[model samples]
Target: MISYEWRGHFENPEVNALHAEGFDHAPLADDWWGQVTRHSLGWVTARRDDTLIGFVNVAWDGAIHAFVLDTLVTTAERSRGVGRHLVATAVDAARAAGCEWLHVDFDDHLEPFYFDNCGFQPTNAGLIALGTSAPRHV
Candidate 1:
């Protein structure tokens, strides 16, 4: 069974290691960890048998909208309810914070999953991010 907890206890290297295995961004660089812990509404992790299996995060202005970030489940733990649970947790947090909307910028493939599973739907006009120019490729 999976269980959820706020505050990832990043001091635990195992938790950081697990994230490395499953996420686009991982291993929880010190600056990233500090920023997320300091700026996000809260961060959550899912665990089974003391091993971190999944995680999600909510970032909000603390009074309005909240964005879902870092939603991921370890390969070994997918196909269970971990992703749903993470979404549920974010939803609850957003509602509690009096957010008018919970927004996510996800890959096109996720539209259906987010819509059917999390009650999210495309807006008549969705958001866009514009920059003067793309940053130099690493």
Candidate 2:
């Protein structure tokens, strides 16, 4: 059985592994715990038994707007409504916290999941990639 938690306890390595698998990349030593606790409105975790199978970070503008980031589900757990549940949990938590708007950005392939499944409306947005390399100090 799968269980979900909001602001739940999680280890960096487990989340890192899940992310690597989901995003198809190598695991980096990301400080997920520290980052979320410090910068996010909250986060959701999906687990099967004791294994971390999914995660999503809810970041906010420190007031009325929240953004979804790093939504991930383990490859084996995909297409099982786990991702939708995670976003639903996030939506409820953000609403309870008094956030007026929740935003998410995703690739074209995720339009149906975000719009149809999660009920997010389409919106005009912009982005500017600052190059792959780390930014240099002025």
Tell me, what's the RMSD of every candidate?
3.9, 2.7
TM-score of decoy 2:
0.94
Clashing pairs in 2: none
- Local distance difference test, per candidate? 0.75, 0.95
lDDT of 2 by residue, 2-25 (tens): 999999899999999988998889
Looking at model 1, residue 1 earns an lDDT score of 70
Global local distance difference test of model 2: 0.95
Enumerate residue pairs that collide in model 1: none
User: What is residue 70's positional error in candidate 2, in angstroms?
Assistant: 0.5
Q: For candidate 1, what is the total of clashing residue pairs?
A: 0
